[model samples]
Target: MNASRLLLGSFLFALASAASAATACAPTIDKPWVRSAPPGAKSLAGYLVLRNGCDAPVTVVDVESLDFGMPMIHRTVEEGGVSRMRPAGKLEVPPGGELRFEPGGLHLMLMRPLRPLADGDVARVRLVLADGRRVFAEFPVRRAAP
Candidate 1:
């Protein structure tokens, strides 16, 4: 009787694992990282590359982080010889396309961390898409570039 119960549990676990794997989104996240900030800093920035392997467009509507008070998508634009940061409402990735968030360009503005995040720490973020798909990515915190 114990053996039979164990086998049943294993089968259920396998079935659930397969279902979760199948439901995961097709967009692959690479090079996810956040810039290290000083203690008591009000905000920090993160960057990453998102590659869409699906045949249809993927729209990333929101970003959320448990460690931070707010995670917002932003872009740095230069106008009139001045650079300013602006909120990026939504970013869309085309089929077989790639979106890059880099320095001096698009980035994730992580505001009001619950605790101080130093270098070598990992921050988990969730990406919410327009199609009701939620994907997670871990961003490693690194020292700022000199």
Candidate 2:
């Protein structure tokens, strides 16, 4: 009877450890940033680095910003020697990997500013993950040199 009880305890411990490991497999965000709008400019852009710690891929479905009327994922493409902005449907990050949004690449297009953002101010942005997790980030406003 004692041997059977010991085996059962060991099995329970292993199950608990497995559960903890699975819970840790979620995506994380780091160093979220945003570019300050130029004087009198109505819109701005944001960038960030996302790390996927999960064993499965994660998709970013949408973004929400309190300071802008609408937030959309956008990318800059060059066609016919002209550069233009286009909408990105969704942002994806691979398992145990990272995705970076930087200048001249995939970025958040913050449109229709509700109010003027001053230098050194901070804005709150929320990123919605496909797994229904919401990540909140505080992006600083700084002057982007021309």
Candidate 3:
């Protein structure tokens, strides 16, 4: 009957729309920022919130920045009243989940700046994933908190 045919057509259209939306979904970087260091400082820290909107997990294998020589993921560890920072190697974000990089916790160690960065400067960085996907984001440089 025509009524059944109409219902089926609507269902198919809805399914197609959902599929298209899913394909359009991509990982996003939110609130990206970098800390301004002293004039002679060699290294600095970057922070951001990475969100995974796809259906599969994404692994951030490496990070690169045009302003810095080598950027790496690091975690702060505290034990016996002492705090230390260590490389995290790689980070994974589950589907529909997010990873937060903040001070006194997970952060990006940007080393050996090619040029000095000042407050209000924007730093461009790329997040390389294991699946050969690269996500680019611009981080605004902010003054270091006192």
Candidate 4:
């Protein structure tokens, strides 16, 4: 009886692992990272590359983070002589296409961390998709862009 129970437990664990792997097969995030900021700073920058391998477009409508009070997607634009940032509403990645979030361009505005994040710490974030699915990514906090 004990042997049978052990076999059942192993099968369940394997099934759970396969489910997680399948969810990450499409619309994957690569090299997600957060830039380290000085202590007491209100905001920090996050960068990552997103690739969509699905048949249809993947639209990221919102960013959610337990580590940050407010997390948003933003684009940096230069108008005349001034550089400004505006909210990037619903960034879409075409099928088999890649979208980049880097410095001086599209980035994650990680505003007001719930707790102080140190270098080497990982910030957990979730990209809420338009189709009601969420993709998860872990951004490592670093002094330089990764």
Using Cα atoms with residue i matched to residue i, what is each candidate's TM-score against the true structure? 0.81, 0.77, 0.80, 0.82
Ranking by TM-score: 4, 1, 3, 2
Q: For model 4, how does the per-residue alpha-carbon lDDT over 10-107 read when each residue is reduced to its tens digit?
A: 99999999877656556988999999999988999999999999777888999999999999999999999899999999888998999999999999
Name model 4 segments beyond 4 Å from true: 1-25
lDDT of 1 by residue, 63-90 (tens): 9998899989999999899999999888
> For candidate 2, what is the lDDT?
0.82
Query: Which digits, one per residue and each the tens of the lDDT, describe model 2 over residues 11-43?
Result: 999999997876666676677767886767878
Residue 131, model 4, lDDT: 72
Lowest lDDT sum, 10 consecutive residues, model 2, at 137-146
How many clashes show up in model 1?
0
Model 4 TM-score, all chains together: 0.82
Score residue 69 of candidate 2 by CA lDDT.
Answer: 91
Best-matching candidate per lDDT: 4
Better of 1 and 4 by lDDT: 4
Error of 3 at 87 (Å): 0.8
Superposed on all Cα atoms, the candidates' RMSDs to the truth, in angstroms, are 6.1, 4.0, 5.6, 6.5
Worst 10 residues of 3 by lDDT: 18-27
Measured with C-alpha atoms, the lDDT of residue 6 in candidate 2 is 98
